[model samples]
Target chain A: MQMLRKLSAGLLLLAVASFASTPAAEAAGQTLEIVKKRGHLKCGVSQGLPGFSTPDNRGNWTGIDVDFCKAVAAAIFNDADKVKFTPLSAKERFTAIQSGEVDIIARNTTWSMHRDTALGVDFPVVNYYDGQGFMVRADLGVRSARDLDGATLCTNQGTTTELNAADYFRSNGMQYEIVAFEKADESVAAYNSGRCDAYTTDHSALYAQKLKLSDPKAHIVLPEVISKEPLGPLVRQGDAAWNDLVRWTHYATVAAEEFGVTSKNISEMKSSSNPSIRRLMGQDGSFGDNLGLSKQWAVHIIRAVGNYGEIFERNVGVKTPLGIKRGVNALWTKGGLQYAPPIR
Target chain B: MQVLVLAAVLGAMAWLVGNVQSNLERQNINSGFGFLSERAGFGINQTLIAYTEDDSFGRVLAVGLLNTLLVSALGIFFATLLGFSLGVARLSRNWLISKIAMVYIEIFRNVPLLLQIMFWYFGVLRNLPSPRQAVSIGDAIFMSNRGFVVLWLEASAGAFWYGLAALGLVIGGIWLRRRAANAQITTGQATRVWRPLLGLAVALFGGAALMAGVPFALDVPHLKGFNFRGGLTVIPEFVALLLALSLYTAAFIAEIVRAGINSVSKGQREASAALGLPESVALRLVVIPQALRVIIPPLTSQYLNLTKNSSLAVAIAYPDIVSVLAGTTLSQVGQALEIIFITMMIYLSLSLLTSWAMNRYNQRMAFVGNNT
Candidate 1:
């Protein structure tokens, strides 16, 4: 009896050891397979940034970035609700994705050259065009980002914003002391206390923060686009096929917008003679076979989150309280920077 | 069985750490404390110690260590004062006072400290009026949205003179106490010790003033346009963190103190009373001295706990070691293996040092009580 129990215990321990060792034993091959077998895509997202990944009263998350993750779910499983949202702080998002705690990270992360090459992660597409800017109290009498010389700037730590703010100030031959915090809320409080002379972040975030402030009329974001912050989503490096699927989910949205297919109008536009739209919607043939998806993969994404422009306008763009106009985020046909490659 | 158990645990830990290291290194990630010598080149928000973006990472870690020690040390001092007072009051005869003390402990002990910290920070501290409309304690003091500001004396060389005089007074007090004790023992007459203590205090204070008064000047805080100009600024985040930590830890300390005081035999107070001692003297000269032996060991552990708990300062952005080293530096460098290892080692060393001091304290008290 004792021998049998001991044998079973030894077998259990070996199984556990093998489970733990599998990550490195076959990391590249098993990682992609494990994610597919799990069915639900685990995606890390921002903590309650209204236009990014904020949750509603019922704890159901909805935002532009949240929709991006949902669209990835739609493409993968033909189900929009198959994404599990992991709420992460600014510091934890990238690490969480890298450690395989999340299958992908759909947080409003910026795509930089250093991040592309050094971070060991793949940024799929520049879904949102953003720029670094500063917001200051109108009562402070400071006019532009240049006037922020010698000012104390409250920026969120663990971000490109910190380095960008520094470069912006330094390259402009101006000097400013940085007062960074991990959370956006803490930075807002410090800025609101007049402890800071300016608050710097992506320009859209400035508008969101101002709307939440006690005095909305009291602050104005300066008119300086300092750095090129091409905001996008990312996944862990390796698995070229998985990377393609995640990247093109974002591309599908932009492509749909360019093809004049809004979510409300997509089901009706299905019968059109446009060859590009037919190919994109998988209507012309089984175009998604090589990539391993339903023929209507692009249609599923559009139905899930609408087109790129619709998601933007609903969240942080002109229709929202932030009232930010799409300057560079507009479609390519409309003389903006958003241009996607051919679906076929 | 024990040998097998120990071997298995050790082997597992070694494998886990090795796995993490190999995985990190395989990604072309260089892993070592060698990064400490590299340029930090990143700015911090709320650093007390000297730091610059141009400083080395080792210098930045030192800054974090200093901030952690400062907050924890300050919390220990304040918590002791609050705890001891509440402990005594709970034992008081007055119902109202004891009830109030009981309420204080119960309220603080039950509520989550993080929530309390947030409440104090956002609800109370954030509502403080702007600097120009600051409340003044006196002409020399101001309180506002930023924090309290008091008139500080900028001592010239006289500060050194004052420090020397104060040291002399402490030595003088010791000598006087010894003399008084000798007179009581040998001559069977009590010599007073208060007058000499007073004389030493005044002489030291006066000499420091008359000597070189360390180039003293007070830069009293002034309410400027939208901010305070002149006096030292203590931000609300730090104040809230300290307040929440001290109050939360004090509730636990008060319970420890009460348990210690109750553990002392009633016979101690009875014996002192039979010798015609007054209540205050009986408690202070007899009960307190005995109860302290029971009190200190647990109280030392509470102090250590408070120190560890202060790492939660990351939630409030206080720039403690956890926030700066573990959160910011680890994320920026992505050297989790090295960063977390260094952090754990620092905390372990701190804890071991604390336990060593507590053990020495226990030994001294054991000798003093049992031998008598």
Candidate 2:
């Protein structure tokens, strides 16, 4: 008994000591300096959501969210390939960021008040303007979400889409059942196997997941967009410098699209007389210095990922399998919500 | 020395908690159980009690707890029944029966429980036909990918009086049983107890039904817009989780039981036979009762394992405590510390309760010594 007591006490002290050291390590907020020294940006993304972050056959990732991480990498290291992707589930994404497992979460997470305030993470920019929508079988004849009364819907758990569906059903005085799964693939499989009447998620995700269905052409996305889902990248709160770096990297892409700067023509447009272009290209001011980056940061971003429009059109545009239109994701000048502060 | 050790442990715990609180405050994340009252604006697939999107997070946890208990209870009941049968069958003299039991025990015990759950869920249950072309039985029960729906009874106002009448008949039957036992002991008369009790129960129930008009209406299930509208809808998740948990735990339980029976001395069986007791009676009244002393201890562990293993219900989305409270609610609330601590405490309490109940039974079956 004496030996057992001594051993247990020793074990307790060791556990307490180890746990005491972790909070101090996690409390260090110099994420940018750590990323710089580590030589790579650790990015958390969805396990497999097409047009957001899905791995290709060659193990290379291709999506709008993937490009955003690459854009941040390009701004910091001038090399977009200096990023390691950690695929995470919906329930694991925020914890991954808070636990310092990843520098940023570009997993197409919605920017909600509760998440922004309580999750200890900050949504720096809205990379994609999405909304919760439903997709049902074409033979079901459900043309709109309003017609989905008494329907059983399948969705990914721990997502804003689940809460949005609940609110929509309740406010509309409709009776419905929701079957939520941990992984996106499981929810989609459940929906495809006819366990649910419809599958609901962000509109872009619905279009992306539809292609994975056994008979894609048999499904129809409803016209109703129920809740606004401003999807974006997340960084740990209290790291203002890292937050600014990520926020500006996304704005640089939007500004590049507004200035008609393509990766192919970036070299020729460097000497252009446009002041905004000059400043964005790092030829005019100390804009990058304030963000703790090099002067050619935006140039590296443009050259690496070729602006917001290029990334979108390449990954999920009209020519791609997702074929999502640049509706609200288009620039403000083009009657959309994509706006950026002046580089000066 | 023990008090000094306890003080050191408590000091370490206090310091650790203080460190966590400081870290949470620094990160600006609120930490408390106060969020339990917040509106859970989410939907659960299966709930034993009434739940809605407007309910509080506390209500969601309650619903999840009830679901976990429901599956664990049903799993324990079925596993015990199947395990005892398999245990006896494994000791059977017949070659085919014993081999079949051996093969079953070997196969189920070797595989991981999570994979078995997924196999039953995705491979078997999800492959059922859709609601549009549901396989129906008698136009009242429906089997679809949505679930297995069976006609259920809805009680009316007359159910109360009929229930009281049945309760009175049960009490009267118990009284008659005591009187019959007294007569057997004192007068050596073998009075028939069961036949009269059964006859009285039937007559009383029949009269109650005649006056109360059966007190129940059958609620039939029919295809609605998306799925079945009525009846007792047993979701596929529950069935798959229950089936996998029961079968997997029953395999280990069968082994424990068989070993227990084998441990009984051969003299005990032979001695009963020498007294001219029939083989079945000797096994039940003598051998089996002694075997239980060996069985109860390890069998308690199997029960606890099944209860804890029910957490794998998260894999198949059964809306058990782990799936709804720990998986979904923890993600939404982001209170990993508080939620995980509570979940651990729940599982610990459940295991301890199971151990306590089994210990009580073991005490009752323990051999009592009499010294003269």
Docking class of 2: medium
Any runs in candidate 1 off by more than 4 Å, and if so which? A1-19, A29-32, A117-119, A147-155, A165-181, A186-198, A264-275, A283-287, B27-30, B155-213, B223-226, B370-372
Cα lDDT tens digits, model 2, A105-215, are 999999988888997889999999999999999999888899999999999888888888989998999889888898999999989988899999999999999999999
Measured on C-alpha atoms, candidate 1 has an lDDT of 0.80
Task: Write down the worst ten-residue block by lDDT for model 2 chain B.
Answer: B363-372
Residue B169 displacement in candidate 2 (angstroms) = 5.7
- iRMS (Å) per candidate: 3.5, 1.7
What is the TM-score of candidate 1? Answer: 0.88
The segments of candidate 2 whose C-alpha lies over 4 angstroms from its true place after superposition are A1-15, B165-192, B203-213, B368-372
Worst 10 residues of 1 chain A by lDDT: A23-32
lDDT of 1 by residue, B1-372 (tens): 556655666676677678766765544445667778877766765577777677787887888888888888889989999999899888989999999999999999899988988888777886776666778887777777566777777666657887888899999999999999998999999889999899889988888778775557788777554456666667666788889899999998898888877888887777888999999988787777677888898998988998898887887667778887887777666666678888888888888888898889888876555413
DockQ for each model: 0.35, 0.66
Model 1 RMSD to the real structure? 3.7
TM-score, B chain alone, candidates in order = 0.89, 0.93
